[model samples]
Target: MGSLRVYATTGLLIASLSTLVHAAKLEDTAPYPKAEAGFSRQVIYLPQQSEEENFKVELIAGKTLEVDCNRQRLGGVLDEKNLEGWGYPFYRLEKVIGPMSTMMACPDGKKTRKFVPVVGDGFLLRYNSKLPLVIYAPQDIEVRYRIWSASDKVGTAIQE
Candidate 1:
């Protein structure tokens, strides 16, 4: 009976400790720099994922472009920059420029405003739920991201 009570108390203590750890804010961990003029700062907080699975974070930054059903690619890039003193990472989209699109004539006569994602060298960041991802972009553009992970199962490669 005494052992059962001890286990219950221990479980509650651990749960409370876990809650406290997660409740801490990113600013509390370290100071991230402020966004410069003409740029807006964005933050992403990823949930704690299973440790066994490999995970990555990708940034999707761009602007909406008006189109007539032609395939479009936004012209711009996201440059990864680090905080001056801390060396913490952040992304910057310098300018939002063109929506270079396929010249295919639109069969339909209607136009639509669509979100054109930016393409660059890339934005595949390491997944760390403990730190918040910070991004800065021109105030005219939008910033978004997606979390990617790999399954644990490994496939045998065919011999050459």
Candidate 2:
């Protein structure tokens, strides 16, 4: 009985330590540079199962931005700025209004995709893109996001 108790205690310690390490890594990767500039305003549609909901926002270069909506999905391009042909740090999504979905389409028609529900308002996405990362938020709530680049602040976008 003593041996079993010892083993159980050891296992619990290992599990707790692993959880702590994982949490630390996540904290370290959180977005930074609270502000950014060089943004242009644009209108994006959050598609709903019933009807398409539209929201206007300002997109800044080199920063992360997010849209908010519920039962809706946000979809848009990265504009003229191209991340192709150069190695860049993996971009991460810091938060969301709802669930998050991502897709990358090659000029040759190949595509990569992922879908994850936003558990709360604190979900983040991380990706390394050969092309600009195109994202979709599939929920019916306001979306928010942060970029994970040390050299640039998180992108700003105003909702309309």
**Each candidate's root-mean-square deviation in Å?**
10.4, 21.8
Model 2 segments more than 4 A misplaced: 26-160
Over 5-115, each residue of candidate 1 has an lDDT whose tens digit, in order, gives 675466446534544555546577567766888888777766666671487877788778777878877767677787778877777778766777788887777898888
Top TM-score hit? 1
lDDT of 1 at 45: 66
lDDT of 2 by residue, 1-160 (tens): 6965675466446534544444433224333222223322221221111111211112222213342221224333332322245432222233334334444433465333323223432233332221222222222223333222222247879999
Per-model clash counts, in order, read 0, 16
Which 10 residues in a row give candidate 2 its minimum summed lDDT? 46-55
RMSD of 1: 10.4
